[model samples]
Target: MTASQDVLGEVLADLRAESAELDGLVAGLPPTGWAAPTPATGWTVAHQIAHLAWTDQRALLAANDPEEFRREATKYLAGPDAASFIDDGAEEGARLPQGELLAHWRTGRAALEEALAALARGVRLPWYGTSMSAASMATARIMETWAHGTDVADTLGVVREPTDRLRHVVRIGVRARDFAYAAHGLEPPAEPFRVEVTGPGGQVWAHGPEDAGCKVTGSALDFCLLVTQRLHRDDARVRAEGAEAERWLGIAQAFAGPPGGGRERRGAPAPEGDG
Candidate 1:
């Protein structure tokens, strides 16, 4: 279901907050830092932000002119490797001077936000996967920004400040619980699963059947990191109860696309405050 105006406003606020935080992380980086390799294999800091800029521009197209967006997508799909689109685009974009890439991202995000706010109520916009409401699109944008920001932060040996804004990411993770199973060609369990995550501020955010037999519980940041595939589920503090919930945790994903071949065990250190 689409969020009401008040809820959408909150989501948009969080989206801007996430972008601002990421901007701070990359704003003053030297050329070396921009060229630094991130956790995403073969993607540098420039590649990461470049992808965000490209995506925001495409998402804005989806919001304003889906037909054109679909046509462009069809052209992209005709390429040999559909999965390599982001990688290829990022590599190309990385060729631009660092200042130009950053300026492009700032402009693209502003345009995307404007386009999203102008969307009519109850109207669904086309996306790479399922169509989405403006609220969902905004939330998805925030989730991606934050996830990529983590990679950039990690490469620089910096820690990002966490916030309750992650609740949007956690909500999407819970909602896509069944999709995770289906993406693996497994039938989602018939019964509902309970999810309880403690946010950064210690506020409890719960979803699903309040009395469901299955449950997943963990720190909200850990849950978000897991769903984004940034942290290996096994390496996270998140735990599950009941068979289906346990399996879901093993393959959970909030982002759209084929199930990601998630990050492997690297003895990766936990995010700030995760311990």
Candidate 2:
């Protein structure tokens, strides 16, 4: 199998595992916890779960009608406080009963998987403002699941193991370095950088050139969590090898769109025993 396919397979596995974890967490949430506030401002656990379901449903629909998808998304954004509205949807999703919310999430996820599985290899699907193939789309989903899943896990004080599958999400974050740079009105780094993530069971996932001018080295989970802004930069588990690499490290983003609020560098110290 091709490297991309292998990476994609790992991503699919992560998605399934994350979905199961979310199911259990949501299912076990008490009614009050469902409405409890998450770290996201003004959002509750319910909103996050709901947003996932809604986004999956949208993805399934958009995969079949790219133009219409763009139009609808544009329209959605045209509304006043559209960004806040979208955030509200995610935060409010957990308001429903555990069973009902889980059912919706499962249904949307299944439809998305089916839609993606049916795509022809190399066929690009419209997303945000770019075109992505089935593999890329799947990887994006994996990143989203892992990033958002962190929020849920944090609220519940649950520590999740770093799976090898997170490599895909990390890769997406690495690839998006340019986007993040551009979002800040800065030019992207001229030279490519190396990314190394230490996975579970002592596995290491490396991307970009081996002798790249810059290097990002850390535990796979920490790297993923850091780039996604789920964890702060000073979390102490991630490290950079070059000045440019460290600059990119401060503003790394995996998801689409402009740079977000950005992340604070304050957190715990890096963990010992680098991968």
Candidate 3:
């Protein structure tokens, strides 16, 4: 297969694996379980999955009708309710019956995969703030699935085992370094920092200029948790070797949208191990 096709296949495979794992977590839950509050303030377990479904719908629209997607996006971004649109969409979906919501999420995910798979090479889909190729879109979906799935698992007192699928998340986190700075109105460092993390399979995954003085190193789980804002910087085990690199860790964001109010610094986790 061509390299581009290979990327599309690999990323979509990982996306399916990540989504299926989260589905397994919520599929068997009792109706009452949907109401369990997660770490995201005012968001329930149902809201988490609902948000995923809502975003998947948006992704499908972006792939199928970029012009319409842009029009809708511009309208939303200009409306007074723009700040709360994400919450509002999740709330609307969460109000459905548990079974109905589950089915909606499943259908949306399937439609998204099919739409993206049929796209031609070098096609770019417009997103909330940027555009991406089919493979990049799939990787972003995987990253969100794993991050939100972490929230759901935490709510249910379940500890999810980190998997190699996080390579996608890690890559996004590393690539988004400049976006993170720009989101916060700060200029990124002139030189790229070397990022090296131990992967789930104990393999070392590295990025950036090898000769750069700035560096961030940690377990993949720790970095993912931090970049996704699922874990506070104080609670993550990631290490930074330079002043700028350290500051980047403090503002790193892997997902699109506003700068997140990250989880509170709860010192209980003891910064010794990976999430």
- What tens digits encode model 3's per-residue C-alpha lDDT throughout 61-113? 99999999999999998999877788889999999999999999999999999
Better of 2 and 3 by TM-score: 3
Among all windows of ten consecutive residues in candidate 3, which has the lowest summed lDDT?
266-275
lDDT of 1 by residue, 1-275 (tens): 34487777888889999999999999999999999988777778999999899889889999989999889887877777776776677888899999999999999999998888877788888887678999999998988998889889989999877898899999888888877888789999888889999998999999988899999898999999899888887788888988778788888988876776667666753332110
The Cα local distance difference test for each model comes to 0.85, 0.75, 0.90
Q: Please give the RMSD to the true structure for each candidate, in Å.
A: 3.8, 4.8, 3.3
By lDDT rank, best first, the candidates go 3, 1, 2
* The best candidate in terms of TM-score: 3
Model 2 misses residue 124 by how many Å? Answer: 0.8
Off by over 4 Å in 2: 1-10, 77-79, 91-98, 262-275
Pairs clashing in candidate 3? none
Per-residue lDDT of candidate 2, residues 118-169 (tens digit): 6766778877646787778878887877777777787888887766667788
| C-alpha lDDT of candidate 1 relative to the true structure | 0.85
- For model 3, what is the C-alpha lDDT against the true structure? 0.90
| lDDT preference between candidates 1 and 2, better one | 1
- TM-score on alpha carbons, each prediction: 0.93, 0.87, 0.96
Please give the distance, in angstroms, between residue 40's alpha carbon in candidate 3 and its true position after superposition: 0.4
CA error at residue 269 for candidate 3, angstroms: 13
